[model samples]
Target: MQKSYEEILEEFSENLKVLRKKQGLSQEFVAGIELSVRNYQKIEAAISTPSLRTILIIADGLGIHPRELFDIPSLKNRPMVKEITTRNRKSAKKKTTKK
Candidate 1:
């Protein structure tokens, strides 16, 4: 089954929090550098969808690769990752069958 947009947003928010805490950075520290406290709070709370540019700024503030924000290690066994992994395996099976 596919995840709803809201579900994905929730996952993203959880991922954000996990990564931030893992690095021992407070929300204030994260916001103080490049983003506003309110905006960062909203994003982390899953209350808003950030633009691509905002994502870039966030990744920079987190001192991580931008893609890491999307593919979180803590969420590797979560719904989104499971769904994607299942889909990829299905695709690979199809390719092999067609060969």
Candidate 2:
């Protein structure tokens, strides 16, 4: 089976918090440089998903590569991780096939 959208976001959010805390950085300190506190909090809360640029900025703020943000081993396999990405597969295929 495939993963659902919500599951992915929830995992990403959890990963973000874990990575941040593991580095001993404060949310305020990280947000002050490239993002607003509210926005960072929202991402950590899984209430909002960050764009590619935001992800890069966040990774930079954390002193790690962007890919490290998604270093969760559980994010792989199972038709794209658990079942959070299944419904979007059709739409994603459409984008690649259209052009």
Candidate 3:
């Protein structure tokens, strides 16, 4: 079945939030890609839909392919992505602290 528009938006928001946090980045940093902090916040909050250009800029800022932002296979997919992101963040923190 096709996902609803709202579902896609919500998934995108969750994915963006997880990806940003996993990189230990601030909203301001992602906002600098091509938008204001308020706009970026709206995007992550699912309050506003982003244009393809904005998505590309965000993907570039996050250092990931744009496709990753929309790769949800199912509703259950988000939690798995979030779990991996959390683990990656923890591992990165450990590496940083070790230095």
**Highest-lDDT candidate:** 3
Model 2 TM-score, all chains together: 0.73
Global lDDT of each model? 0.85, 0.83, 0.87
Question: Which candidate achieves the best TM-score against the true structure?
Answer: 2
Question: What are the C-alpha RMSDs, in order, of all predicted structures?
Answer: 4.5, 6.6, 13.3
Error of 2 at 92 (Å): 21
lDDT of 2 by residue, 1-99 (tens): 455777778888899999999989988876766799999999999999999988988888888888878876456665433355666787799999999
Question: What's the distance in Å from true for residue 24, model 1?
Answer: 0.6
Q: Model 1, poorest ten-residue lDDT window?
A: 72-81
Candidates ranked by TM-score: 2, 1, 3
* Candidates in descending lDDT order: 3, 1, 2
The regions of model 3 sitting more than 4 angstroms off are 75-99
